[model samples]
Target: MAKIEMKNPIAELDGDEMTRVLWAVIKEKLLEPFVDLKTEYYDLGLKSRDDSDDKITYAAAEAIKRLHVGVKCATITSNEARVKEYNLKQLTRSPNGIIREELDGTVFRAPIFVNNIQCCVTSWKKPIVLGRHAYGDVYKNCEIKVPGAGKAELVFTAEDGTEIRKTIQMMKGPGILQGIHNMDKSIESFARCCFNYALDQKISVWLGTKDTISKTYDGNFKTIFQKIFDEEFKAKFDAAGIEYFYTLIDDCVARIMKHEGGILWACKNYDGDVMSDMIASACGSLAMMTSVLVSPDGNFEYEASHGTVQKHYYRYLKGEKTSTNPVATIFAWTGALAKRGELDGTPELVDFAKKLEKATLDVIEEGTMTGDLARLANPPAKQVLDSWAFIDAIAAKLK
Candidate 1:
């Protein structure tokens, strides 16, 4: 079969650990054979990032912006241990964080539901797509550990030399204080991205926040999302037979647990960070979760929600076979390819992407999967394959 030619290049950000090893094999066995892969590749490995002073990550983000599509492998975000282990110049920031900030995007995470895999929440029959507003709030907060008694005040200074101050706490003893903020522009952008993504995916949108308590802070998010939905998306959502619902975060959680989910749950940054992981665990292993960062302008960067398989990589390095799941990584590629194909008007490429995804899922459904998924499989997989063997199984299915 002649390979399906790509009309545009994908900005491919490579990474570290076992996923990186699977990345090479996946390309050779799955993508390269069936598609004329055109990619502007950047090695985002820890060593490479250190060698280049992390400029490579910035360049990769720039390329994704220019090209409008990216598929990323899981990379190491440096910590004290990692810095010492890798012998790095300094502890670097998360590559994902850098790219997300550069793109100013919302992260959407959805699980890959297989027929044989049992969901922990037995009530959840459909996939729940979670859209996390990836900017501001507690993530960019000013925190202070107050020693002894001190007055904690919230102060705001305007450009015109006006000052507004309010005492938050009159501490009699040592306490902690934090000042968190979100930009209106960023919130508006996040709202639009969620609405646009829901519209594109033909799913209902659910916005949740602690608006009842944090009337000004969380209320702003609710208000912005509501305004955007009413002004921009109401007509389209109605036409598509979908609805946008809003409720308190606690209520939303209760409702989501009871109801069968096919809804896009748009969450505040902190809520999203916690809830996405919960949803991923309930649905299946983190390896089965797929994530995409979608900008307001529709640029996308796809990646697995799970981290690099560091333990698996170490075992493999010691010449031991390891069973690391690659489902999410494979889906990441399909997502990038499908979007690229759609943008470039190549239906064949889009179809190829779909088929590749089907192939991966079909392998899982057929009771051939890595150790993690096998453990979760219904009746359990009697025979579990190592990482490479599983990829080969998917390849055979594709053929």
Candidate 2:
């Protein structure tokens, strides 16, 4: 078959660990074989970030903005242990966080359902999409260690030299003080993204926040979402036969447990981070979900919701084969390709992407999968394969 032609290039950001190993194999086996691959590649591995002082990360984000689409491999967010392991100069910030902030995007995650793997939550019959605010809050925070009893104050100074101050705490002992903030413009962007995505997916939107406690902070979010919905999206939502509502974060958790899925639960940064993982695990393995960051201005960044398989990577280094799931990563590629095709008006490329996704899920539904999914397979997986073997199985089907 003649390789599918591409009208545009995608920004491909590579990363670390077991997923990084699988990234090359996936491209070689599944993508390059069928499509005339065109990409602006950037290495986002920890070492590269350390070498460039994370300039590579900023460049990758810029590429996505220029190209309007990107596909990323799972990356490492170095802690003290990882800092030592990689022998890094400094503990760099999360690449994903930086990218999200740079792009000013909102992450939407949903489970990839297959008949063989049953949802752990029996009540969840459909997919619950998680719309995560991708900017501000704790992702960008400043902190200080309080070595002794002292007073901590929150102060703000204007450009004109006007100042406002509030006492945050009167520390009676050694403790920690942290300050996190969100911009009104970013919040407005987040609100519009959720509403627009819900309209696109034809699903209801549920926003969860703690307005009762963090009145000024969380209340601002509630107020903005309502204002945007009423001012811009209410008529459209009514026409689409969907609804939008807000509830306390705690109440939202309870509601998620009992409600039959199919709603877009828009959450604050931290809430979405925690809840998306819960949703992913409840549906199946973390590798069974798809994540895409959609900016208000129409840029798209596709990536797996899960992190790099660090333990599995360690085992692989010791010459031990590990059965790691690659479904989410595969979907990340497919999602980017499909979106690229859609934007470029290349239907053949879009069709190829669809076929590739079908091939992946079909293999899983046929009882041949990696250990993570094999354990959850309802009729019991007939054959459990290692990482490479699993991709080979899907490649065979793709061919």
Candidate 3:
């Protein structure tokens, strides 16, 4: 049978191990049956990444920029252990780091609900989407240790030779100094991405920052989000029946823990760092979460939230069956493909994407899943399917 014409082309990034195997099966069983997909394929496997000196990662990011959609598999993030295992130079940053920098997009994580895993927040009937600024704060702070402190000053030098410096006194004999910053332009981009995502999803947007404490720094985020909302998104939001709300970080976090999840909460860099972990633990498996990068200009890239199941894949290579959850990785493909279809006005491709999501969720609801979620299973139900078993089931359901 001739493959159906895909609505638009999407960049495909293949990764390592069990997920890498699952990636091919998903394509063969689900995507190939329905669409004549044009994918700009890039190998992001650890071996290939090392072989190409990691140029393939940069090329993949560039391809996604050009094509505007990319579906990535779970890839190994290099650590000291990984470095020894792969025999590489000092542990290089993750391939995701390279792509994240190149694309300059915001990472938003949303949970997949299954009947088996218990959520921390019982009221979360809908998804609590987190849009993390991801630019500065602790992730890029400049720190120095004071042998014997005198004074610490944060100095900002303007391009026209103007300077503004604030001196913070050290009360103790030995102290630590930290100077952190966030550019107005970066925060502006973050605001735009969050606001756009909220509007696009037809969901409410909430800005949370330490505005009361970091009056100047966090308040800038507050001001910018408010200004942008009023100037840009307010009218559109009102028309769509969504509200843009701003709350102090302390209040927001406390409230979010109790509230039913539906709003798109935008956090500063540090808040995002902490909250993502909290949300991940709450929602169940990190393997079940899907991440997407939404740029200020509305460019989208999707990927699994977890790293390559390297350890598990290695066992599988030795002829041992492994049960690596492929749901998040699968969603990455459907998410990118669906968005590409939506962007290109291909309703059929979009429909297929939505249905594919339903099919995967249906399998889980039917009680068949991989190790990550299976462990979380209330009673390790009778319908549990191994990795390949689950994949075949989803494909059959899709048909």
Candidate 4:
């Protein structure tokens, strides 16, 4: 039989480590055989990124912007250790950060639930989607290490030379200073994305921030979201029988413990990074989460919420079989394909994506999974296959 055809190409950003190994195998086994895959491929591997002076990362983001659909494999975010390990030209930035900034997007992460793998949090009957503001804050920060005593000040100078200065700290000894910033415009965009997503999913939007402490900084986010919701989305939300509310971060955390999920918990940049992982772990493994970046202008980029399986990759390099979970990665592909098909008006392509996802979940429900999920499986996975074998099982189910 002929493979299902795609009307347009997907911007495929490839990555590193064990998941990178699984990336090619997944396409060869699960996707290529079943679909006429068309993608503008960009190698976001560390070595390639260094060789291109990180231009490839930007190019890939541009491709996603142009195509309006992207599927990314988890890539290594370079650090001092990574720079030496890969012999990189310099300390390169996170490819995910670059893409998120380019797209001006919000990341929505939700766990992929299977019947056999129970949630650690018993109260979570439904999936709790985390809407993360993907721009600014600690991800883009400035830091300085003081040698001795000095004064630290935050000064803003207007174009007309008007100056507003505030004292941060008066250091008496060696210390460090860090500055983080967020834009009003970016916050506005983040608010719209969350509200739009909530309306689409028919879920309540609960934004959490520490406005009482960092009155000005956190207050801005709260203010923007409230203004946008009240001025723009309040009516629509009321019509849909849904609601949007702002709460202190502490209260949100406490409420989440008792809530039955099914809420889009929108968070600021740093908060989202931490909470999303917490949410993912409580639901299941980090690899069980699906992440998607949605730009306000309708662009979508799907990726696994977890990082590259670096440990497994090292073992794999020594010619050992590693059972790394590839569920989130597979879902990333399905997500991109489904969106592509939906946008292209190709129902067949969308159907194929849905079938692939079902096949994956069915295999897990039948107690066939990799090492990571095997430990977490409630009834115990009947067959603990290596990564390749697990994909093969799903392929068989797909066929």
Candidate of highest lDDT? 2
11 Cα displacement, candidate 4 (Å): 0.4
- Which 10 consecutive positions of candidate 2 have the poorest summed lDDT? 369-378
Q: List TM-score per model, in order.
A: 0.94, 0.99, 0.86, 0.99
**Whole-model lDDT, candidate 2?**
0.96
| Candidate 2 lDDT, 112-191, residue by residue in tens | 99999999999999999999999988889999998999999999999999999999999999999999999999999999
Off by over 4 Å in 4: none
Backbone clash pairs for candidate 3 read 4-36
Candidate 1 off by > 4 Å: 145-149, 171-176
Tens-digit lDDT track of model 3 for 49-117: 887888899999898888888889878877778788888755555677677667777889888888777
Question: Model 3, residue 8: displacement in angstroms?
Answer: 4.2
Off by over 4 Å in 3: 47-54, 115-118, 138-157, 160-180, 378-380
lDDT of model 4 at position 159: 100
Clash counts for the predictions, in order = 0, 0, 1, 0
Off by over 4 Å in 2: none
Residue pairs with backbone atoms closer than 3 Å in model 2 (clashes): none
Residue 130 lDDT, candidate 2, scale 0-100: 98
RMSD of each: 1.9, 0.7, 3.1, 0.8
